[model samples]
Target: MRIHLVDGTYELFRYHFSPGNRDREHGATLGVVHSMLQLVQDGATHLGVATDRVIESFRNDLWPGYKTADGVPPELMAQFPMVEEALAAAGFCVWPMVDHEADDALGAAARKAALDPSVEQVLICTPDKDLAQCVTGDGRIVQYDRRRQKLIDHHGVVTKFGVTPESIPDYLALVGDTTDGFPGLAGWGARSTATVLSHYHRLENIPDAVGQWEISVRGSSKLAATLAANRELALLFRRIATIDYTAPTFEHLDEMAWTGPTPKFPELMAKLGGAHLVERTENLRRHRDDDRPQ
Candidate 1:
């Protein structure tokens, strides 16, 4: 069996900015549901979607520069709860994250699904860099970027980041993640960070003195000096970038199965002026039911 874990927050952002999607009464929320239903139409049976109920999380307390709702457009911010409601109404398992972000929830769900002996593959549906760490060997679990039509397995994670899956948080710590709003220490570019981290694998493992370095980076002296001076800050950024697998998202893959839309789904779709989605989901359900043989 295979499972699909979706980043509902990313989907919302994608559809909201997509061409000709802004004007509809509830376009962002409805478009997200339609797209997930497309995944169901394409043979995804067990699925879970994670959404950021409130943009700010406990990470805010850890770092003042952590991401928040302040930068997001008010119109886009407003659609969050509506997205959760619509997906839940459609019978998809929805994790509406509050203290933690959607990324951690999807990671936790992926971890849970991959552990089941009956599960063959777990596909995390997001293009976010933070998710690359969750990818595992032999395609047991992977990062599926639906928009790009790409599958990033463990090898892909290594090729992309020049480090193992275990090193991603360290890599992001050195390189800084503008998306998450955490700035890395000075003198740490992508190439330099990857080269150093590919060798050290973790922030604390790297030697503080440039003279003791085994591999030579472009500006090792300055990078080492900056890192030595602000080692605590670097570790903090790594902590912020790390995806928490123990996010209390799911325990069983069977719990994520899409049984069919809930009774209230049609009414919710009508309320959103997306009556067409009701017809689409109904047709898809009929096809699925017809295909199931006794």
Candidate 2:
């Protein structure tokens, strides 16, 4: 069995800006529900989606500049609950993350699912750089980019990032991610950061002296000085980028199984003014019933 884990937060953002303006109020919710259903129709058996119930997380207190709800558009923010309800009404397992962000939920689910003997592969459905660390070399857990329609395994991570999956957090920390609101050390770009990190494999391993470096990189002096000056900040940024697998309490794959929709799914859909979603739920139920012995 292959387990599919989706980053609901990213999907919501994508549909919010997508053209056609299909729905002013419920377009994102409808898009994400249809997308997940399509995945199931495409043969994904065990699936899970993680959404950010609250934009702020424990990481916010740890880092002053971590991504916050302050910058998020009100339109997009308003659709989060409706999206969760739509997914649930569609007979899919949804993790509406509260204390932890969606990234953490994805990471935790991937790690937990990878341990199950019944699961052959775990596909993390996102292009987030932070998820690279969870990719295993044996193809057990891989990252899938829906936009590019590509599956990035461990080797792909090394090829794309110029460093192994293990080095991605360190790489992102030094380079910084505007999406995550963590600014890395100054003077660090893709080329220089990859060169030094690919050799050292981590921030702590890199020496402060430029001459002591084993690998060759352009402008080693400048890179070394910037790293030395902002070493603590770089580490902190890396911590923010690293997904916490230990946080969520879901211990077994069985815990995530989709028994069916909540009892309130019908009423919930009505409250959101998504009557079409109610029809989709009925269709899903009929399909499931048809698969069973009659």
Candidate 3:
């Protein structure tokens, strides 16, 4: 069996901003529910979605610039709870995180699910670069981009980022993630950071003195000086970038199984003005039953 961990916060934001989504109030929430049903239709047996109930997490205290809900449109922010309820009614495991962000929940779930020997694969379903750090080397854990129809394995991480999965936090710390709201150290761009991190594999391990470095990087002296000067700040950024795997996800792997929609699913869809989805959900349920063995 396989486990599919979704970044529900990302999905909500995606559907909300989509050009075709015209309904301001409930379009994104309903869209996410329908999308989860489609995942079931596409043969996802065990699915779990993680959502950011509160956009301001512990990271906000660590750095003043860390992302918060201040700029998100009230219309989109209001749907967080709505989508969580809709997915729960649709029989998908929903982890609505308050202190930890959705990324942490998904990462923790992926790590937990991958430990089950019965599970063949664990797919972290999101295009977020932060989740790339969660991908495992043996291919048991990977990242899936639903929009692009792409799979990113451990090798894919290296190919795209020029560093191993374990080095992503350090890489991001140096190169910075504008989306996550942290500015990495000065004199460290993608090429320089990736080149040095690919060799050192971590922030702490990188030599403070440029001359001690074995590999050649452009402007190595300035890069080393910048890193040495702000090493503590860089580490702080890394802490913010690293996903906290301790976030509680589930007690058992079977909890993630899709057992068809709950009784309230149709009513919730109706309330959202997605009556067509109600009928579609029933058809999908019947299809699942038919596929079952006697």
User: How does candidate 1 fare on TM-score?
Assistant: 0.97
What is the C-alpha lDDT profile of model 2 across 182-279, one tens digit per residue? Answer: 88888899988888888899999999988888888888899998888888988998888889887563556765554455667778767766666666
Better structure of 2 and 3 per TM-score: 3
Top model by lDDT, which number? 3
Candidate 1, residues 14-41: lDDT per residue as tens digits? Answer: 8998897954448999999999999999
Estimated TM-score for each candidate: 0.97, 0.92, 0.99
Residue 271 lDDT in candidate 2: 70
- Model 3, 2-44: lDDT tens per residue? 9999999999999999998999999999889889988998999
Best-first order by lDDT: 3, 1, 2
Specify the poorest-scoring 10-residue window by lDDT in model 2: 254-263
Query: How far out, in Å, is residue 136 in model 3?
Result: 0.8
Give model 2's clash tally. Answer: 0
Candidate 2 Cα errors over 4 Å, as ranges: 258-263, 270-273, 292-294
CA lDDT scores, all candidates in order: 0.90, 0.84, 0.93
Model 1 residue 106 distance off true place after TM-score fit, in angstroms: 0.7
- Candidate 3 residues lying further than 4 Å off, grouped into runs, are none
> Which has the higher TM-score value, candidate number 1 or candidate number 3?
3
